[model samples]
Structure formats: structure tokens, C-alpha cells
Target: MSIQTKTVKAKTVAIVGGGCAGWSLAARVDQLSANTVTLYLKEETNPSHNWGFWQMPWLSDALSKKRAMWNSWQIITDEGIVTHHSRNHAYCSITSDDWFDWCQKRFHSAATTTEIIRLPVTNTDKNMLMTSNHKKRYDLIYDSRPPKADKNILLQHFKGLEIKTSIPVFNSKAAVLMDFRVSQENGIHFMYVLGYDQYTALVESTFFSTSPHREEVYDEAIRDYLSRIYNVTSFEIVKSEKGIIPMGDVRPKDQNPFLYSIGSNAGAIRPSSGYAFSFIQKQITQFLDRQTKPTNPHKKHDLMMDLIFLEVLKSHPEKAQRLFFKLARALNGDSFARFLSGEANIKDYFLVINSMPKWLFINQAVRVIIEKWKRIAKWA
Candidate 1:
């Protein structure tokens, strides 16, 4: 991080939508500079997820505390359980409410000029943030609102229930990262369990599909999963979170340099994998560190690979599970986690490329190249 010996506060910054990216930006600005930041929270919207990520190198931007963290995680497939424990790279999570509250507390404690209010943004123009009442301008406006999905999109949708069990029944030390024991009815379906303690955990049922499914579908799946996997008959739902994140290659709606797009709107989400917490931290961290701003987190190579992977999902939906299973089997836990977390090295990429069916990727790559050439020729 390039520390400015001469402290200069960036005054008047407006952050739309108090989501992960918005809060991260606001908190960083509050710490680094005296920037009078305005954080706009949409009406009747709570914070987003108990976002978990690797707690090293990128923890600076996560705003995680000792109180809100997990040490390890696991993956369960039809075959068996795959686990990884790294002291250097501990897995951690921060409840959305806790993080949001911390941000509020930070700005308040700092005695800086940070205004946070419930002003739902009606629309966003090129350079202006339109609210229900007033038109506000800032030196720089950071928008974290999600963009519209593509027509032919595969959404990674989920509904999770944070339950407190009546009896102590969880391994607080480890979290189930992915359990492929559930039926892949809509698409590749899995259940993720984040066990906070012996009696508390967030059990989530997630799917990747072309169309959206009802809450009942997820609710039923979660019930069945909890019953069969954990054998938990009694529990109280403390909190629930449901979201539909686009898995198709839909570019961010607003990519204008001056009018910054910071969260999912900024393409922090990977097209193939809908994991955004790590990338979100990376984006905000780079911006704050005076390093090259990560306006585009998805590299061209990653996008291309995702296109081929999504092709398999769209064209041959049945093969999606096998493809992912093979991928996991090929790479160790750390490598797979790193790849999913957007910290994969070239070797990791090569490992992924070599693991998948060569014919599928080669065919897709050739087809994409030909289509591109045809487009260029027509333009010429």
C-alpha cells in the first residue's frame, strides 16, 4: 500500500447501495482519508451474506474480526469427504449484520463526516446518482447495485437458513464447503454448511440453472438435506438469505471509468463460479492501496474458459456435475479453493485445463475463434 506521508482526505464521495463493495469502500475511505462519504442503503434491505474467504493476504479489505471467523472447511461428494486445513490460510466469515454494524461504528467512532441514510436509488445516469428525492454529486461515485441478467443466463441461485439447533450438533472447527449429495434436478445442486459452533450453522441449498426456481424448491431441499445429512430434526431459523447471481457472461451495465462500478455490478463475480467475496476484497483493496484499480476482475483467459464450461452446462446439462466433480478430484483442496477464490496461478490454470475433457474445450475454443473471425470479417 502506497502510504501518503502527507495526509490528503478525498472529500465528498458517494457510495450507492450499502452492500459488500459499498461498505468496504466506505470503511476504507473512512480509515485512509477524511473523505466525507455518503452511504445510501436501499429501503427495507438488510446486508447480504455471512461472506467467508481465505484470511490471508486479502484479509485487509474483508473487515473481519477475531470474533467472526472459522478455521477450516470441507467438501462432501458421493465418493467421500475432502478436507483441507491450513493454519497460514485460515477460512473465515463475517455475518452481514456484524460487518455493516462495524462500518457504522467505524465511521461514527472516527468522528469523520460520513452520512449513511435509507435513500433508495431510483436510477443512475452517466455521472449522477438519482434518489427518490435529491440529485447528489460527488468527486467520485461508487455504484454497487447489481445489473440486469442476460436473456440466456444460468443463475447461481441459493436459499440458506442459519439455524440454531436445539441440541449441540456441529463441528464448529470445520465448514462443509460443498456437498453434492443432493439431487441435481434443476442443474448442479449442492448444499453448503457453515457450522459456526456445535449448535449453529447456515445450511444452504444452491443450484446453477437456466431458469429461476421457487423458494419452496430450495426450502424442501434444505429440509431434506438437514434431515438426511446431519440428522437434525429440531432447529430454529435465525436468519434466511436468498439470491440469484448470474453465471452467464453478462458484462457489468456500467463500466464507465469516472462512474465506478464496485461490486457484482463491477464484475467482481466470476462467470463460471459465483464467488465474489474474495474478488470484492481484492477490488476494493487495490483501489485503496493506490495500486491499479481492478475495474475488470475477470481476465480474458478466465472468461474464455468460463464460456466453454458454461457451454457444457447449457448444451449438455447432465455433464455439469461430472465436469465439476472431475475438476475437484483433479486439484487438491487448496488449489481448487485458490482457483475459485481468484488467486490461482498459471500452474493452477494448467492443472484445471488438463483435468477437463480436452475434446469439449477444444471444440468450444475453435467454434468461438471462428465466430470471432466471422464477425471481424463482416465488420471489415
Candidate 2:
């Protein structure tokens, strides 16, 4: 008797970092196959966070259960408020503690070997990860370390406070996506308020500039908005969260099939808008289809459009309030979400370009094209 046999190799994957990017990747991978996965986390303690990503098809049902969802969101401008409905795909948020717990539970339930180690892995040095406990070399290792931006990068920095008010205050049904009624002295300033309920919410003062505004600048503005706008004065600060995301020029994309670079380091975050959760979710879902070291021609049109948008904002920071509000008004509900997710087609984008301040955008667009072609000419 002749028998033909095949040996299946166990795929071992290692992910370094414990932020939303790493956690999501591990959870998705674990759900798909019985492959061994190791997680290296730097934070010994959970950094409480509220990660909000637009609902996507790849978003697992298990993870969806833990999020706080919003059906509608409003953007405040000098003219008035523009509200967008998320009927099909809602804007959702999940806490860091809950996400970490979910990942841990999944790993524990896995039939294959899986671990969430607290050891910090800096570089891709294989021998360095070898220890008394773990000595196996990973077939694939993903690095989620956030890269440091240049000094002139336009940052979306914010300081938020999640407070519990004495009485019902916030609009529990609709979230305040951006209130651009604040003073624009220190770059473009706005308040992002998300309400879990009428009594509880996260009120954040956000600034779009190179350096963050003073703590007092945000603190005072937040208090004023609460008192003046919502009539919310008596409230206890439950917790505070702070973050900095890039809203600058085009970033270099460095990714590969195996030993991939994931998260913000891989340019998952949209440069014009500081939204990476959706992009990260999309990238993690396609574990096998990642591009290695993306060049200018990969998504040339989309990248160029985003770069031009960012350039307009950087060159004329004062125009952000008008540009953002107008852009929101131009796009429909579905299109707005698509734009945020970086999946907007030419038609959707053209609608936005037409809504902007023509002179401001036109000048920036010309400069961006000239500079890009100049670089190409030199390289050629």
C-alpha cells in the first residue's frame, strides 16, 4: 500500500505593542486560525482609552458587543450645526480595559499556544526576544511602535475629561463631533463631546497645531463650553484622557507580507484627519495582503489629495473651521463615513474639493503638485 501524507507547519506570529492596533491584530488572528501568537506589551498597567472606529464589515460580532454606539453625530460651525446620521454603520467606541480583557480571554480559550506577555520588545532582533520561557523564533513579527513625527508636523492634540454630571445635560442620542466655536488664537481649536448618557460624557478640547495648547487653555475653554453651551457646571471629573495624532504631510509607508510594520508607524492614520482605527481594522483583517514599502504610485491620487488638503490646513490654519464644516455639509452621511475611512472615490472627493475655499485650496494644491513633480524630476 502507498500512502501520501502532508505536514502542516504551525505558523507562529509575534506582535509587539499593546495599543489598539496590536490588540486588534492579535484578536483577529486568533479568531481565524489555530496558529500560535505571542503579544509583547510595554504598559504594565492599562492606559484607559476610548477608541472610536466607524463600524466596518471586518469588525467581529464579539468585539461589537463591548462598544458604546452613536446613531447620529453633529458638527458645530459659525453658521449653524450640521448633523449626520449613521443609520447603517454607527460610530462606536470601546474602552482600553474592555478590549484588553477580551484579547486575554480569547487567548486563554485558544486551543493553540497564545500569550500576552508584559515584556517590551523594541527592535526586530530575534535573539533578543529569546528567554527562558520563550525561545522560539517567530515566522512573522509585527511592530506597532508609533514613529516620531518631524518638529513641524501638524498634530491633533487633545486633553479630555470624562465627567459625571449631577443632572442630565448632554444630548445622549447625538454626539458633538466637533464644536468649532472656540477661539482660534492657538491654531484651530474645537471641543469633541461624546455622551454615553445624559449624565456622563467625554468633553475634549482639541487643537490642530505643531505644539499643544496649554492645559489651562483647554481646561478654561471646556468649563466655558459646559456652562455656556450645555449649562453643565456641576460635574465630577471621572477620568481624563490625552492623545496626539498626526494631521500633517504624507508619511512613508513601510510594510511587508511577513515581519510587517503595523499601526501608525505603517501610515495607517489619515494625515488630513487623525483617524486610524478604521484603517487599522481594515489592515489587520488582511493579514496576507499587505503592501511592502509603499511608493508614490501605490495610491497616488488619494495620497496626493490628502496631502493637498493637509497642506491647505498647515499653510492657512485659520481656514480649518470653515473648511471642516463646509466639507461636512458637502458630503452625505454615508459619504462622510467613507471619507473618514479613506475609501472615498473620485466623485465623493470632488464633492469635498468643490466645497472648500477655492483660493486657499487652489494655492496649496498648486504648491503640492510643483514640489512633488520637482522631487520626481530629481529622482529620474
**Highest-scoring model, lDDT:** 1
RMSD in Å for all candidates: 4.2, 5.1
Point out where model 2 deviates above 4 Å: 1-10, 31-35, 44-46, 126-136, 249-258, 288-300, 374-380
What C-alpha lDDT does candidate 2 achieve relative to the native structure? 0.73
Q: Give the per-residue lDDT of model 1 (tens digit) for 43-71.
A: 64553567767765867645445335555
In terms of lDDT, the poorest run of 10 residues in model 2 is 1-10
lDDT of each: 0.74, 0.73
Off by over 4 Å in 1: 1-11, 30-35, 61-63, 66-71, 110-112, 124-126, 252-258, 291-294, 370-380
What TM-score, to 2 decimals, does candidate 1 have? 0.86
lDDT of 1 at 323: 75
Question: Looking at candidate 1, what is the lDDT of residue 53?
Answer: 75
